[model samples]
Target: MFWQWLTAPWQYEFMVRAILLSVVVGLVCGALSCYMVLRGWALMGDAISHAVLPGVILAHVLNLPLALGAFVFGVGSVLTIGFVESQTRIKEDTVIGIVFTGFFALGLVLLSKVKSTIDLTHILFGNVLGISNTDIYQTVISSVVTLTILFLRQRDFLLFCFDPTHARSIGINTNLFHYLLLSLLSLTAVAGLQAVGIILVVAMLITPGATAYLLTDRFDRMLGLAMGLGAAAAIVGNYVSFYLDVATGGCIVLVQTLLFGLAVFFAPKHGILARKFWAKIDL
Candidate 1:
C-alpha cells in the first residue's frame, strides 16, 4: 500500500512533467545556492527573484516569452543595484530593498491594469501541476545552460566568492565573475518560475545550500549535498502535495526547511547538538 501510494502520482502525464521540471529547478537552484551563500548574496537572490515580476507582466502584454522578460528584468535589477550602490553613498542592501520593492510594485500596478489572463497567485506561488510542455522545455534548456556554466567555472566562482581581493590579485576579473554570477542567478530564477514562483524561489536557492553548509566544511561536498537535498525535497514535496492537496511549491520549500532544521541539530560537526556533545566530552 505504501509503495502504491508513493507511485500513484507517476501514473499521470502532467505529474511526470511537473516532477521532471521541479527536479531540474531544484538541482540548478541548489548548485547556484552554494555560490550565493558563500558570496553573502542571499538578499541579491531575493531581489532578482522579486524584481522579475515587472518583466513577467510586460511579457504578458507583449505576448512574448515570460522567461525572456523575467531574465531581462532580473539582470536589469542586478545591474541597477550595482550601479546605484557604486555611484551613491547608499549601501547595497538598502539599494536592493528599494529596487526590488519598486519593481514589484510596478508589476502589481501593471498587473492590475493589464487585461490579461495571467494569474497573480500562480505568479507569486507557482502552479507546478499545471505546467505545460513549453515550460518544461524552457526550464530544461535554462537549467542545462546554467548548470554547464556553473560546472565549467566552479573554481573561478569559488575563488571569487571566498575572497574577491585574492581573486583580483591573482588576475581573475572579479567584475566579470560578479556579473556572471548575477546573470546565472537570473537564469535560475527564470527556470524556477513554474516550480516555485518568484516569492518562494529564493528559498529554494537558499535552504539547500544552508542545510549542506551545516553538514560539511568542504565546498565540493557542500555542492553535492545541496544538490542532492534539493532534488530529494522536490520529489518528496510533490508526492506530499499530491496526497495532501497542499501547495506544491510550499511543500517543497517546507521539506527543505525541515531538512535544514534537522541539520541544525544533527549534522556531525557543525550541528548544535553535535557541538554541545563534543564540548561536554572535552569538559
Candidate 2:
C-alpha cells in the first residue's frame, strides 16, 4: 500500500513535470544558497525575489518572456541598492528594504491595473502543478545556465564569500564577481518562480544551505549536503502534497524547515544534542 501510494502520483503527467521542475529548482537554489549564506546575503535573496514582480508584470504586458523581465528587475534592484548605499549614509539593508518594497508595490499596482489573465495569487504562491511546457523550458534553461556558472566559478566564489578582502588582495576582481553572483541569484530566483512563486522562493534559496551549514564545516560538503537535502525535500514534498492536497511549494519548504529543525538538534558537531553530550562527557 505504501509503495502503491508512492507510485500513484507519477502516473499523472502534471505530477511528473512538477516533480522534475521542483527538483531542478531545488538543486540550483540549494547550490546558490551556499554562496548566499556564506556571503551573508540572505536578505539580498529576499530582495531580488520580491523586486522581480514589476518586471514580470511588464513582461506580460509586452508579450515577452517573464523570466527576462524578472531577471532584469532583479538585477536592477541589486544595482539600485548598491548605488543608493554608496551615494548616501544609508546602509545596504535599508536601501534593499526600500527598493524591494517599492518595486513590489509597483508590481501590485500594475497587477491591479493590467487587464490580463495572469493570476496574482499563483504568481505570489506558485502553481507548479499547472506549469506549462514553455515554463518548463524557461526553468530548465535558467537552471542550466545558473548551475554551470556556479560550478565553473565555485572556487573563486568560495574565496570571495569567505573573505572578500583577501580575494581582492589576491587580485580577484571582486567587483566583477559581486555583480556576477547577484545576476546568477536573479536568474535562479526567476527559475524558481514557477516552482515556489515569489514569496516563498527565498525559503527555497535559503533553507537547504542553512540546514547543511549545521551538518558540516566544510563548504564543499555543505554544498553537496544542501543540494541533496533540497532535491529530497522536493520529491517528498511533492508526493505529500499530492496525497494530502496541500500546496506543493509550501510542502516543499516545510519539509526543508523540518530537516533544518532536525539538524538543529541532531547534527553531529554543531547540534544541540552533540554539544550537550560533549559537555556531559567533559564533566
Candidate 3:
C-alpha cells in the first residue's frame, strides 16, 4: 500500500506542488528569520503574517492573484505600524496590537463578504492538499528573492541586529535598513501565507530561529541551524501528514515546537537546563 502511493504520488501534480511549496516556504522563512530574531522582531514577524490576510482576501474578492494583494497589504501594514508609532505617543507594542487587530479584522470582514462564494477556510487555514504549478514557480521565485535580499544586505543586517549603535556609527542607513528589513519580512510572510496559513506560517518564521538561538550564538551558525531545523520539520511533517492525515503546516510547527522545547532543556549556556547545572556545580 505504501509503495503504491509512493509510486503514484507524483502522478498527481497537486501533490508534487504541495511538497514543493512547503519546502520552498520553509527554506525562505528559515533564512530570513535569523535577521528577525537578532533584531528583536520575532513578534513583528507574527504580526506581519496576520497582516497579510486582508490583502489576500481583497485580491480573492477582486479576482486578482493572492500574492499581489498580499504584498501590497503586507507592505502597507508595516508602514502603517511605523506611521502609528510615530504619530501617536504610543508604545510599539500597543501600535502592533492596534495594527494587527484592525487589519485582521478587516480581513475577516472581507472574507465574510465573499465567504459564500469562496472556500474561505482554505484562505485562513490553507488548502495545501493540492497546489498549482504556478504556485510552485512563485514559491521558488520568492525563495530566491528572500535569499538575494539577505545576501545583499547581510553585513548591514548583521550589524543592525548585533549592535545597531555601532552600525549607525559606521554610517549604515540604519533607519532605512530597519524599515526595509521589516518590509522584506512582510513579503516573506505573504509568500508563505497562501501555502501554510498564518498560524503555522508565522510560527515557522519564529520557531526555527528561536531553536537556532538555543543551539548557537554565532550569526551564521544560527542561520544554518535554523534552515536545517526548518527543512527537517518539513520532511517530518510531510510524512506525518501523508501517513497520519494531519495538517501539514501545523504538524511542521509542532515539530519545531518540540525541537524548541528540547533546545530549551538541553542546549548550551543559554539553555535552562544547562544554566541550572552550571549554577549547581559552582555552588
Candidate 4:
C-alpha cells in the first residue's frame, strides 16, 4: 500500500506532464529569484506577473500565442514604470504599484468581455493538471532560454544587482543588464503561468530565494539550494494535492512558505533564534 500510494500519481499522462511542467517552472523561477532577492525587486516580479494578464487575454482574443502577448505586456509594464520613474520624483515602488494595478484592471475588463472563451479562474490561479502539450513545449523552450542566459551572465548580473555603481565603474552597461533581467523576468512569469498562475508566481519567484538567502551566504550555493527547494515543493505539493483534492499551485506555494518559516527560525547565521542562541553562547 505504501509503495502504491507513492507511485499512484504517475499512472496517468496528465500527472506526468503536470509534474514535469511544475519542476521546470520551479527551477527557472528559483534560479532567477536569487537575483530578484538581491536586487530588492520582489515587487517588480509581482508587478510583471499581474501585468501580463491583459496580454494573455489579448493573445487569446487575437488568436496569437499566449506567451507572445504575455511577454509583450510584461515588457511594456517594466518600460512604463521605468519611464515614469525617470521623468518624475515618484519612487520605483510607487510607479510599479500604479502601473501594474492599471494593467491588471485592464486585463479584468478584457477578461469579462471574453469570459466565454477564456477562464478567468485558470488564468489567475492556474490549472496544472490540465496542461496541454503546447504548454509543455513552450515551458521547455522558456526554461532553456532563461537558464542559459542566467548561467552565462551570472557574474555580470550579480555585480549589477549588488552594486550598480560598482558595475558601472567596472565598465558594465547597467542599463542593458537591467532590461535583460526584466526580459528574463517576463519570460519566466509567462512560463510559470501554466503551473502556478499569476497570483502564485510572485511567491514562487520570491519565497525560495528568500529561504535560500537565510540559509546561505554563497550566491552559487544559494541558487542551487533555492532550485532544489522549489522543485521539491512542487513535487510534494502536487502529490499531496492529488490525494487531498486541493489546488495544486496553492499547495506548492504553501509548502514553500512553510520552508521559509523553518528557515526564519533555524538558519545558522541569519535565523532569528540562531542569532539569539549564538549570542548566548558567546556570553
Error of 3 at 43 (Å): 2.1
Candidate 3 Cα lDDT to native = 0.79
TM-score for candidate 1: 0.97
Task: Note the Cα lDDT for every prediction shown.
Answer: 0.90, 0.92, 0.79, 0.92
Writing each residue's lDDT as its tens digit, candidate 3 over 1-283 gives 8788665555666666676677777787888878777778877888888888888778767877667777787778888998989998999998988898788899888888878866766766666776556656666776788788888888888888888899878777788888778767777886667566776678778888988988986888888888888778876677677768888767777888899999999998888989999999999
Candidates sorted on TM-score, descending: 2, 4, 1, 3
Model 1 Cα lDDT, one tens digit per residue, 10-88:
9998888888889999999999999988888899999998999999889878977777888899989988988999999
1 or 4, greater by lDDT:
4
Model 2 Cα lDDT, one tens digit per residue, 220-251: 99999999988999999999899899999899
Please give each candidate's TM-score: 0.97, 0.97, 0.90, 0.97
| Model 3 lDDT, residue 163, Cα | 86
RMSD of 4: 1.1
lDDT pick, better of 1 and 2: 2
Deviating ranges (above 4 Å) for candidate 3: 1-13
TM-score of 4: 0.97
User: What is every candidate's alpha-carbon RMSD to the true fold?
Assistant: 1.2, 1.0, 2.4, 1.1
Flag regions of model 4 displaced more than 4 Å.
Answer: none
Off by over 4 Å in 1: none
